[model samples]
Target: MTTEHTGTPRPSDAELARIAAELRALGEPEFDAELEATPVASLVRELAVPTAFALAFGPTDSALPAGAADPAGAGGLLDVAPLTELDRARVWRKIVARRSGGAAQHHGPRAPSWRATWVAVATAAGLALVPVLSTPDRAATPAGRAAAEALGSQARAALEGVPGEQDGGRAAELAAQYSARLSSSGSEAPR
Candidate 1:
């Protein structure tokens, strides 16, 4: 039955889902007799030449073909001189250079800057201090005092173990003793 146009607005999601379900219920469509009889190869052969011509010459329906020969000698591509051997070599070199990242290297490596050096130094210093910062304050603890005494004893033993006479053995021994005392006293001030 022919229904007159209702001029309805866009269908809702529900309407669309219903339409889709109806379409899915239908099996594969049967081609008309004429279309069924037409060979695909024959169609391709018929259109191939025209398609190639249209592609090469641009759209055929236009009044003048695209890139049509300029009449007033506006210096089209045909007028240009062929590349010389040197020109060809230069072009090839440029292409190879670009492919090999040589084009990027034209500016060369960046020179070391004072700011970058300072940043690197600061980073290294921060990294060096990380262990020191992460460790808990041990100077006030009894364990720290025992550790300092052990270190001082080890240092004295190490000094005695040396075969040759030390230049400032007395001074070194005194410094070790002082360091141990300072560690046990929980004194933050540098001696």
Candidate 2:
């Protein structure tokens, strides 16, 4: 039977359940053949790329801050004028004020809590770790090994990434060396 175009609306849950029951009534077909045609791996690959980008940079609508007047998201990103800069600074100042003990005054003082102390310590530790984890040195591949890799080595790059099983002490040493160099050079360090 030919089905008419019904304004392109999705089928209701009840309709979907009825259709599913009917499909089940017909003895099991080879799902393997249908799955091979539209493999789950290919489906995941199609969806995962978009999902990763979304998680990394957030949605297009979210690129703009809340209470922004623009509906079309027009003009260049930098064209938001002084509003963007001031808004960012305003948000950052509030974050600093709240984290510092200013929020306690607003909410009225209470006994010092260990949970807040633990959270503050954890946050500080995570922030300290960011710089160390951001830039990683690629393990020095042996000179002989470089030629093999350059000329199509059989070794595939692992999903877990380049396995640099270095001791944590080595990372600490690198950080110390970098800090010493900065102190000696008097670069004033980056903002």
Candidate 3:
């Protein structure tokens, strides 16, 4: 007599339990293989060259040589003659003299106008009153101070609990473990 086997293979209870335990114990996979395969160096070079070029050339506007609306002529459109060292020095002296003359005229003795005097007094009064009006009256109540202190203490405690230095290292390790597990198990972890 011939015997026939039918239907799908059924996993035993023990086998199922073992599989679940393995799943729980597994962490993320090492993504080193994928990272190694990636052309990270080339990508870095690609990103750096353009950024450096942009910085060296300044902004891409009318100010830049390439970004100019018209590039047919050498230098800029302005036809101002190039100044010699002597010419520049003379021009500088004239500008200085004009500025000094203006300053002397303004500072020379003069009676203050009624409108100017009142305006100066009003401006001084406003400046004096600003700090007084803007400053919050912290001494107005004891309850407000107590609440602020309590909130500050709570924030300090929360900040203290954070593992500052080891945070990035721990995160990287966790990510690697997760990737490894997902790869081995052939399942995508939920986001």
TM-scores for all candidates: the values are 0.20, 0.17, 0.24
Better of 1 and 2 by TM-score: 1
lDDT of 3 by residue, 1-191 (tens): 01111332323322222222221122101222221222221111111122333454343321222222233222221232233445434433533454354334444333245457889999999999999999987683678878988999999999889865457987888888888888788777635
**Candidate 2 colliding pairs, count:** 0
Considering TM-score, which of the candidate structures 1 and 3 is the better prediction for this target? Answer: 3
Which numbered prediction scores highest in TM-score against the true structure?
3
TM-score of 2: 0.17
Please report how far candidate 3 places residue 13 from its true position, in Å. Answer: 99
Model 3: which ten-residue window has the lowest total lDDT?
Answer: 40-49
Q: Against the true structure, candidate 1 has what lDDT? A: 0.39
Q: Candidate 1: which stretches are off by over 4 Å?
A: 1-75, 102-129, 132-191
- Better structure of 1 and 2 per lDDT: 1
How well does candidate 1 match the true structure in TM-score terms? Answer: 0.20
Once model 3 is optimally superposed onto the true structure by TM-score, how far is the C-alpha of residue 160 displaced, in angstroms? 2.8
Give the lowest summed-lDDT range of ten residues in model 1: 40-49
